[model samples]
Target: MAEKNLLEAFLKAEELEIQGKEFYLDASEKAHIPSVKDLFKQLAEAEEFHRIKIREIYQTFQAKKNIPAYVTKISQKQISPVFDPKEIEKVASVVTDLAALEEALRLEEKSIQYYQSLSDKSKDLKVKRFLLALIQEEWGHYLSIFDTMEFLRDPSSWYTFKEHWGLEGV
Candidate 1:
């Protein structure tokens, strides 16, 4: 019964990753800004990686009837801040960009919540750890999208706050 549940969770996770990858790919193609496009591409790659890893784990679990020990080592790529403060002026207030960012944020949040719930229900420590790792990656994606939204809304304020530059002198 537990194995069935685990397998179901794995299938759901893979599906979510696939959806995220497709959305990001489309968003990347539609993005006008180079930085935004690159960021979306990076996200799409990460989602693809997660989908692959989930499939591998699912196959291993089916054959072995247990979570793999190496599952803990599965990690997503760490994405650095892509938006440059200098390029802030170049980022026009495009409604589609903001709308896409909002949608991306929603997708990431859903993934995080799903993983967290799955982790809580998991009995195996390795499976729990794997879900936790996925949750963290989704959170990273969420934060990246959120930061991009903030930058789009008000680049100067976002840059000032992100860079920790004092505004007292002004």
Candidate 2:
């Protein structure tokens, strides 16, 4: 396998993920709507998981090569997620569940893009594949949030097993 310079992008991905998690956590605490707060909290944890996955990739590189470049003093600070404090305060009060859902979707999209960039930069095919998987997973997360938002506001779309089985209206 060719040596990859994907270390930079991967590190950035981790930094951004951490930043996103912090945003979500902050929003969760400030949001007045219970459902929205819970949703934000869920997203915060999700971002943390994504960050862990990226860290695992770095560790894998270290374990496999036992090298120095992978073991660096450099932190993933370049692509770190940064939310404007004023914006957070403003949005926290006015954001509905739908709005928060949309923001979460955007954040997940950012993660997907970062992962895709990192994956493309990876020289090792295994790392590339792992990153691709992460990208797909992030897309799924974005979609799931959209679908959940849909379900939350539209209970008519939700069908219980009994209803689907024609056991309802009894």
Candidate 3:
């Protein structure tokens, strides 16, 4: 029964990843800024990678009738900031970009919740670990979107705060 539940969860996760990838691709196509477009493209790739991993795990579990040992190390590619300070002024007019970022945030939050819920219910250590890794990745995506949103809202302030820059003489 537990195995069945795990298999069902894997299927659901794969569907979620596919949805995320499609959304990111659409967002990338609609993005006005090159940096934002690149970010969305990277996110789409990450979602595709997740889908592939989930499919592989599902096949392995189905064949072995046991959860395979998951590696503790989850590799994530570093994503650069979504805007350059010089081009930040141009982003002020990008309301659609902001809207897309908001939607991305919602999607990532949903994925994190779904993975966390499944991880909480899982009895198998390997299954739990795998879900936890996914949760971490989704959380990273959420944070990246959030930071980009903040940058879009006020690039100068975001940079000042993020960089911990203080006025030494004023």
Candidate 4:
């Protein structure tokens, strides 16, 4: 992995947030299910928030040329996931549940890796905490996407089981 200064890293993260927001907006427009459409719209808003957060951080700390102390240390855990390209086929529209879920999964997985990397690299305690918060948020997003995929795969069974287990109000 290539090393980047904090400003550069945050700038890259901001760009990613913009892309994520755009993708979510497009997905919302193309979604067939009302619930999925709402989900995408909500995620788009969240991405916008993430973008602003990163931008603020970058602007505040861009003058500092300090490389994080942890940057030189070897990472103990492999944070990146290996996904098959064939599993992420491009779609003109995210109208189908399966297609949209696949794309959402991909995005969440990528975000998880990105935020985790930032968390791992940050030496400042406050910065590390903020990055870890983002990581946790991304992990939650990934889990939600995974759950939605499972529900979409077998709605009847999943929904029924959830309702039976008193977990239907989400």
Question: Which candidate gets the maximum TM-score versus the true structure?
Answer: 3
| Residue-pair clashes per candidate | 0, 0, 0, 0
Question: Candidate 3, which segments miss by more than 4 Å at Cα?
Answer: 65-68
By lDDT, the candidates rank as 3, 1, 4, 2
Which consecutive 10 residues in model 1 have the weakest lDDT in total? 67-76
Q: Which wins on lDDT, candidate 2 or candidate 3? A: 3
Give the poorly placed runs of model 2, Cα more than 4 Å off: 1-4, 62-95, 158-170
Give me the displacement of residue 149 in model 4, in angstroms. Answer: 1.6
Q: Candidate 4: lDDT of 50?
A: 78
* lDDT score at residue 131, model 4, on the 0-100 scale: 76
Writing each residue's lDDT as its tens digit, candidate 3 over 45-118 gives 99999999889888988887665567564556865655676778687788999999999999999999998999
Which residue ranges in model 4 land beyond 4 Å of their true spot?
1-4, 63-95, 165-170
lDDT of each: 0.84, 0.63, 0.86, 0.67
Which residue pairs collide in model 1, if any?
A: none
- Looking at model 1, residue 84 earns an lDDT score of 63
Measured against the true structure, the TM-scores of the candidates, in listed sequence, are: 0.90, 0.64, 0.92, 0.73
Winning candidate number (lDDT): 3
Tens-digit lDDT track for model 4 on 15-50? 888988898899888875655666777778778887
